[model samples]
Target: MDIEKIAKAIEMDAGERLPDIRESLQEMVDGKAASVHTPEQLMLRTTRQKLGLSQSDFARLIRTPVTTLCDWEQGRFNPPGSLMCLVEIADKRPDVLRDVLM
Candidate 1:
């Protein structure tokens, strides 16, 4: 079935494909790796504090609830979909709060 010819072709192409695949894979890895954050916790804490509201008030502002916010901050519960999006945007660009919050 011309296996030798096929193998030779593969061998020649593998060098090019491998590096391209590897570079794309590394870029994906780097993109994912960069997402890890601590600022969500900090901002959730600090901004709420500065506003002189308990977790309850922040939760109300976010339209969740005190218990949910507590659970999220304390790591007992994961932030749900919309909240998680807000958290990511907020953490990354806190200066955009007015825009993001809207």
Candidate 2:
């Protein structure tokens, strides 16, 4: 295999794509680009935010490990249906959840 040739070609390709990459990043920063989030992720994050809690606090309040909560929020894992139902309730009635659960 011609490793050196392959490396050089990759470098050239990256250089050629740099401008487009920068433009895409700029668009994201300018809010011209939209990023997709799954419904579960959105709901979990929204619930936590609505309760005005940080990840660790929210995780503790929900009795889940912070890492697991992070996984759910980042869409790396799907929270169970029961957890989703709780999250929906929390999202809709943050005050109630906080009052009852906290």
Candidate 2 clash figure, as a count: 0
Error of 1 at 34 (Å): 26
Off by over 4 Å in 1: 1-53, 99-102
Model 2 TM-score, all chains together: 0.63
Clashes (N, CA, C under 3 Å) per candidate = 0, 0
Superposing every Cα of model 2 onto the true structure, what RMSD results? 10.6
lDDT for 56 (candidate 1): 71
RMSD in Å for model 1: 11.5
lDDT of each: 0.62, 0.81
List the pairs of residues colliding in candidate 2.
none
Per-residue lDDT tens digits for candidate 1, residues 6-88, read 54566587754333444445566566543343555555666666656678766876888788788777666566667766655
Q: If scored against the real structure, what TM-score would every candidate get?
A: 0.42, 0.63
Clash pairs detected, candidate 1:
none
